[model samples]
Target: MPSTVTSHHRDIETDRHARTRITVTTTADATAVTVTGDLDLATSPRLRDRLDDELKLRPRALIIDLDAVGFCSSGGLSVLLEAVTNAHARGIPCAIIATQRAIIRPVKLLQLDRVLPLHSDRAEAETWLALVARLR
Candidate 1:
């Protein structure tokens, strides 16, 4: 019999100068993390912390939504790379949602897009997660 995991949701907002918000929703198969506002030197730590907290939950997959992000700096990219590395090390799949050019362009330039599974929207990412869950 397949075990069922309960769903959980958390919304964490930071009061830092960059004003980033993180919302994490976890289900049996995956964890969806939505990030909004600027992602720069002043705010990357907040995101890093949130990712760490979610990673501790040990979800089968992690989907990071960056559609609402207004800006992303090198610091933010570093945080993202770290998250991907951490997830992979734990045998968890990780995907990214980044439609806007602001987020996509930089990622492509840095070749991080190749390292991360990039999706255009939440639904696409969720579909991938579903497939991964089914395979597992």
Candidate 2:
């Protein structure tokens, strides 16, 4: 049986500026990280840390929900790329979900979607994951 993992939520403040909310939910199927707020220079570190922690769990898949992310700078984009690389190295499938144009525009403009494996919704993300499954 897979051990249960609790959901983690936190507010990160940097330079008394941007705020980012990161929520990590782990289960037998997959570990999901939902990001809300600006993912810029100051806030990117917090997201990176959260992503690293979730990756450590080595879940069946890493799903990043970026729908609520209003802004994503290079720092934020880099974190997503790094997460994908790390997940691949660990043999864990990864998917990024974004429904809003705010986040998608930058990702597409940078051509990050090619390497990031982005989806408009969780359903679509899962549909794209070839071998991942919910064994429970």
Candidate 3:
């Protein structure tokens, strides 16, 4: 089951399990994606699509808000890595919001924290994006 919602030029997609939802919102300087729910094998594809869609827009910065994520598997991590790689290849700055230890611990264990800067909240992530845009 796939469901999509479009609002104010933003595209939102929810997976069949209804356990995962990805909301993509674009601003003048950045694209912000909010993920809510478990990000595992069953829902990683949805996230990949959403991220790819946002990247296609070629925004100056990409901010992923993962504060609501309860779990993330290797498959989900792969999707994230792909997104970061794609963004970097395009010279787009990417930021992640992972205030929860459940989300932060796995990323840190994999040393992904070094490559993907993690923020404590959406505001901080947005600020980072803004600063990156200003510098570039």
Task: Using TM-score, give the best candidate's number.
Answer: 1
lDDT-wise, the better of 1 and 3 is 1
Give Cα-based local distance difference scores for all models: 0.84, 0.79, 0.81
Q: Model 1, 37-96: lDDT tens per residue?
A: 888888888889989888998988888899999999999899999999999888788889
Off by over 4 Å in 2: 1-16, 130-136
Tens digit of lDDT per residue, candidate 3, span 1-136?
Answer: 0114332345486775656778877666667898999888888888888899889888768888889999888898888889999998999999988887767898889898878778998778877777876788
In terms of lDDT, the best-performing candidate is 1
How would you order the candidates by TM-score, starting with the best? Answer: 1, 3, 2
Superposed model 3: Cα runs more than 4 Å off: 1-11, 16-18
Error of 2 at 38 (Å): 0.6
Between 2 and 3, whose TM-score is larger?
3
In terms of lDDT, the poorest run of 10 residues in model 1 is: 1-10
7: Cα error in model 3, Å: 9.3
lDDT value, candidate 3, whole model: 0.81
